[model samples]
Every structure is written in structure tokens, then in C-alpha cells.
Target: MLKGIPKIISPELMKVLLEMGHGDEIVLADGNFPAASCASRLIRCDGHGIIELLDAILKFFPLDTYSENPVSLMQVVEGDPATPTIWKDYRSAIKKYDQDFTSFEMVERFAFYERSKKAFAIVATGESALYANILLKKGVVVE
Candidate 1:
């Protein structure tokens, strides 16, 4: 085991993060997401929650400063009553890394799936929150 690596991040997930280039996106897929169908590369983080994974990932993974919305989330369906309170947790996590981080772009459900298909990789988590899937665009590490 490495000294600083978070326990939540598996070797596969670490490798995928290292392999990704600036502007490439990775998905933290919720339990309900069709991750297998949407992912080009998939990493299973079963029995884990996205909030913890998100916090761990942001510790090393830089957000795409070039993109207005480096983070993206699946929008709630028109008639769905489920409000994703988890988003507040996401913002809290992001703020820990980027003080200026304000919001995430909301993609329509189908559009989110299409975008996920193009992501460099997807990490499937066991988070049970509805519409909890998030896409994070990679950024360069500045010296």
C-alpha cells in the first residue's frame, strides 16, 4: 500500500486517473447508472459511496480550469420529485480543493449517458442516491 493514496482508490482507478490527459473526463457512476453500457473503461468500486470517492479523487485529481463547468451531473427528470441533496455534499467536497468552485453543469439524463460513453473511464460506485452520477474533467498539474 502507498503512503498517501486513499484507501478508497483502487489500483485500477489510480492507473486510469494517471492515464487520463487534460480535458478528458471520468465518471463516478451511481449504483443506478448504466455504467457497463456507457463506459469505455470501467472500474468497480462496489460498496463505496460517491461522496467519499469524490473527496478522495479530488485530493489528487485536478479539475479542468479551462472548462467553465469541469464538473457535470445528471439532471433530474422533468416529473421526478427526487431532489439530489448529495449535490450539496459534492459542492462541499469540491470547495475543499477549489475555493472558487461554484457549481456543476446539469446534463439531461440521455445526454449524460452519451457523455459518459466518451469519458476516459467510469468508476461505478454503490451510492444509492438518485441522479448521483458525476463527470469530472481532468486538468493539467501546474508546477
Candidate 2:
């Protein structure tokens, strides 16, 4: 096992992260996301929540500082009646890692699925929160 790497990060996930370059994006998919059908490279992270995975990933993966919105989320459908309180948690976690992160770029549900198809990889998690899926853009490792 790696000394500093988070145990939650599987080898396959680590490889995908390493292969990604600046501007590449990765998605932390929610339980209901069609990961198998949309992902170019799918990393199964069953039994995990997006929040924990987000924290672990941000520890190693740098956010794209050049992008106006380095983060994106699946926008809730109108009149869906599903209040995604989880977004508040996501905002807090993102701010903890990226001070410059202001807000999430809300993508239409269908657009989010299309974007997932082009992502470098998608980490499928067991999170059951509504609209919990998050996309993160990779940035240069300056340190």
C-alpha cells in the first residue's frame, strides 16, 4: 500500500487519476447514476459516500485553477420536489480544499450524463443523496 494515499482510493482509481492531465475531468457519481453506461473509465467505489470520496480525492487531486468553474453538479429538474440539501455539504467540503472555489456549475441532468461520457473517469459511489454527483476538473500540480 502507498504510504500517503487514502485507502479508499483503489488501485484502478489511482491509475485513472494519474493518467488524467490538466483540464481533464472526473466524476463522483451518485448511486442512481448510470455509471456503467456513461463512463469512459469506470471505477467502482461501492459502499462509499461522495463526501468522503471528495475529501480523499481533493487531498491528492488539484482543482483546475484556470477554469471559471472547476466543479460541476447535476442540476435538479424543475418541480422535482427533491431538495438536495447535500449541496450545502458539497460546498463546505469544496471550500475546505479550494479556497477559490465559489460555486458549482449546474448542468442539466441530460447534459451531465453526456459530460460524464467524456470524463477521464467516473467513480461510482453508494451515496443516496439527491443530486450528490459532482464533477471535478484536474489542474497542474504546482507543489
lDDT of 2: 0.93
lDDT of 1 at 86: 95
TM-score quality measure for candidate 2 = 0.97
Give the TM-score of each candidate. Answer: 0.98, 0.97
Q: Model 1 TM-score? A: 0.98
Clashes of each: 0, 0
- Local accuracy of candidate 1 as per-residue lDDT tens digits, 36-113: 998889999999999999999999999999999999999999999999999999999999998878789999999999
**Candidate 1, superposed: residue stretches over 4 Å from native:** none
lDDT of each residue in 11-39, candidate 2, tens digit only: 99889888999999999999999999998
